[model samples]
Target chain A: MNIFASLSRKPWIWSFVAAFVVWIATILFTGGTSAIGLSQAALTFAAFSILVGIGQMFVITLGPGNIDLCVPATMTLAGTIALKFMQVDNSLILPGLVVAVAIGAVVGMGNFALIKLLQIPPIIATLSMSFIVQSTAIWTNRGLRIKPPQALAKFTTETTIGIPHVALVALVLSVFAFILLQKTVYGRWIAAIGQSNRAARMAGIPVDGTRFVTYILCAVLAAFCGYLLASFSGGAALNMGSEYLLMSIAVVVIGGTAVAGGNSNVAGIWGASLFMFLVVSMLNTYGAGAGIRLIMTGLIIIAVIVAAGGRNPNQR
Target chain B: MKRALPSDSIRLLIPALSLTILLIAVFYLQPRAMSYVGLNLLFNLAVPIALATIAQMLIMTVNDLDLSMGTFVSFVACVAATFLQATPVIGVLILVAAIATYAALGVLIHVRTLPSIVVTLGMSFVWGGLAVLILPAPGGHAPEWARAVMISRPPLVPMAIIACVVIAMVAHFVIMRSSIGVILRGVGGNARSVERAGWSILGARAATYALAAFFAILAGISLVGLTTSADANIALRYTLLSIAGVILGGGEFTGGRVSPIGAVIGALTLTLAGSFLSFLRISPDWQIGAQGAILIVVLGLRLLLNRLENREKRS
Candidate 1:
């Protein structure tokens, strides 16, 4: 096989290509003086997006119409509650992490229950769940800034050998996700279900159980991000997770994950996340106004999808 | 025929029934709202939301979702406030151009086989960015004539009721009764079959998306008219609100099945829930959660009705 053809067949190649081009554009625009700083910032911010993107990828892989609109809210609720619980105490770091993940699990279960039991559409179910979660956050938060535990904050903010700790955490999680998708039967089960729900059921795969687990897993990951984000950023704010809502979905789609479901792109997420951050930074560096920046972002996403996104399965 | 009527009636009646319950609760809590003035004040704010819901329902009728509905509306509102108010011709032209862009989007989506969700999500950002450029700080005057129309009062019924009745009648006639509406829905219900029948899927999609944009524009104009100002983020909440309204009104996500009358009722029900909240004097923090509860209860009722119907069939 031709090298170019084989590389192109891998859906994720376009994202990496785009990221590299954008990275070059930014460095050149800045007179090539701050490549290291730009790369570091891109990696650090991209880490949060990658974490949420991983969770969204799994859920989206479960087929069309499977999405979690509550990711941002789950993050907000988890971060707020965990920070409050820890109350800046260094000794309670482990318990704080557990608390955040637990909150995520509960929210995940509620989101799935709405979809499975109430027969509500996942879009609407997760949306309504987000509402409740957001309200709960507001009720608990009350516009106060509670400091995260000192050790936890230090761990999240500190870098090792010029690599951000948060990025390292995200790297570990990505490896875990890669293994989960490639090496595990559960991964294959979700892909099968996504490709054909009825066929998967007939083949004796547990569709509902797999979907349930996937939803929980996505929420747990979101919650984990929230915990680390609050610690890194100094405290939890009610609106801390708002940007991630779109960022998570955008990176997942732009990274070449199949929107029609059953395809996963773990590596593409990093490429897409880094590309997204760099693109925004580049536009900002060019002194573009918010309006221009947003328009460019939207247009870039559409252009990328048209160029890189394969023919939608539904079309055939 | 008899079997069909029960299921169909159950689907449509539930929305109206919920709206009635909400109205009663609001009136009971604040009896002063039993009067004509109170009624106008109560429902006047829902007109824009009702229009937004109709727009969402129109998109749903074609089996596509418009995540940009709210932002698009906000953009239109900004255009109406700044362009329409300062230079009426420019404003009308801008609105027309925006609607044309919407039609083009439909064509592009069809030809490209792209996911409508991602496309609309991208469009949301574009619209938001444009709106900000037009009015960055959220201060623009709604046209005087539009404000007059919004606040106009006729003899017995309030302007809101009259506007709603007119809206319901027009939407129902265009989408539910007309030949074009039938084809639009047919495209959604079975695109392949519609294509086989010599109708252009692209045309049908373009028409539906354009009509949805038209309604969203109406929503934005009415919103600015009522508030007498325009802001970029003014209608941000309407995206979710419109989605919930469509669902509450018995519109399914993937089907061509949608009811214009039900959508209006659903919008009214949501607006009333806010009124009921104030009457109950709940903390402002839980107000958003109450809206979620209303969504759950409405959906839960449908589930219960389905179970009951199944039990009756078995028995």
Candidate 2:
């Protein structure tokens, strides 16, 4: 009874349960031959989603009116600009990383300024910011597929002790996020703010500063995902970050984070990300047509939410 | 009721101001657009977008949103192009079912307390998939009636402008002046009080969603009429476009605050902004960015107005 209650309280367990079920089902399709390969591949792709997903989760935790719609645009700009700066020079990889995060920080500040200074809704502010960033990316890309440095590409693709390098990098970041959320004062401040902005202010929390930093952290994570993704895929493409917008949100919601805000979990993000990748691959492996695949994906998302999300308070 | 509606006069002025500025810019860039024929060409596409904006406006009225609007419109367009053109009865049935599905979604969101964005995002995939199944490619022809209705040339003014006027008036009467509209907006302002008044929040939500679905269906048919064909992704951007239009028209995200006439003008202004940019010979790549810039500038103006209003209140 105690274990069951604890499990129920941990919203992320559901996503992990779903992910494991999907993984097993996929393995069954291959008659157990593709288990290791499937797991590795799932982990590899899930890493990218996890990277962006962590960022989105933090923003979503800030409450109902808060969300970051510029993840894809930020990713594109960082990847494109960073790769261009590197020019395939291995020595420039550190600079490239700094450039991506710095761009993310700048975008974050801009997004917050629009919301705070101009009083625009976060949705509109991020969306409009995304458009400008997308344009900059287009201008920078100029139809070029600038490749990453030779060593970085090898590092992204190759495994360290049988774990894909990218997945390890994602794991490290995940740990960092977990620490920030659980073991830090910043995490508590954000949760308090999300629960009730007025109450948080009364409690002497620095609401605006915390909110600002959260946006910056989220953007920085997105940029990191872009930089790593560009390196992993051998180059940057203008449309590269597009798929991630939905992926990040899906993992957070499906992973069982409260959509109403004030509560979030790091583990669920990983589980949901893995499940998303596996589900797609499974549907593809089953010879399902694109239409069927999309329909099933949609239905599954609804089912998970209805089953789990219905337990939360009703929010418009 | 007064609180439910924001500063109404100022709200109207902001959208009108932006529209006039964009219109002047477009005229300066391309003198031909000043004429009836040129104006028609520029605004024909805005008609469908205008309808979609109204649909989004209704959802906003109830403080819920529909992210699947684009895919839903795409699905309806596919049905109109293929099935409606081939057999009217089946097409009508499908559209009716789609509208009912939208109503059901509203009830589901309300009953389960599910976030509309997540549920609608899921529905977007389902609708997109169904659209693909209905029209595997972009080759299906639109129904002849739809084509004729869209191409019908009215006298003295362009068909686009006439459609906009009619749509704006109808939406205004239905959403702003009607009893149901009042009650729904009340739900957005304070659902608890509305409930205390013995109104069913569920019913209001369903009605609002159903009405939005009706407008979106019309948008889809009109879009197909213009293109004479349909694809699964035909109106994918309409989701974002509709949301942006609603915001541009002075619709707030959470409040029941929305203006039908303002929304119509907002959609037209967006279409005109695109035309203005293209006439400036801006690269296709930067055109989207320019739209974003325009949105920001207009919103910044809103800030200025807001500050003035605040100062006046204080004084």
Chain A TM-scores of each predicted structure, in the order given, are 0.97, 0.97
Q: Write the per-residue lDDT of candidate 2 for residues B1-315, one digit (tens) a residue.
A: 134345676788888888998888888888888999998999999999999999999998988878888999999999999988999999999999988999999999889888888888889889988988888888799899999988999898999889988999999999889999999899888999999999999999999999999999999999999999999999998988888888888888887988998899889988888888899999998998998888899889877977877787777
* Deviation in Å, model 1, residue B166 alpha carbon: 1.8
lDDT score, candidate 1, position B78: 96
- In candidate 2, stretches whose alpha carbon ends up further than 4 angstroms from where it belongs are A312-316, B1-6
For all predicted structures, in order, the TM-scores are: 0.97, 0.97
Native-referenced DockQ of model 1: 0.69
Candidate 1 TM-score, C-alpha based: 0.97
Instruction: Indicate the residue-level lDDT of B212 in model 2.
Output: 95
Model 2: lDDT equals 0.90
Q: Which ten residues in a row have the lowest lDDT in candidate 2 chain A?
A: A307-316
Which lDDT value does model 1 have at A69? 92
- Give lDDT per model, in order: 0.90, 0.90
Docking class of 1: medium
Candidate 2 lDDT over residue span A116-144, tens digit each = 88788888899889999999999989998
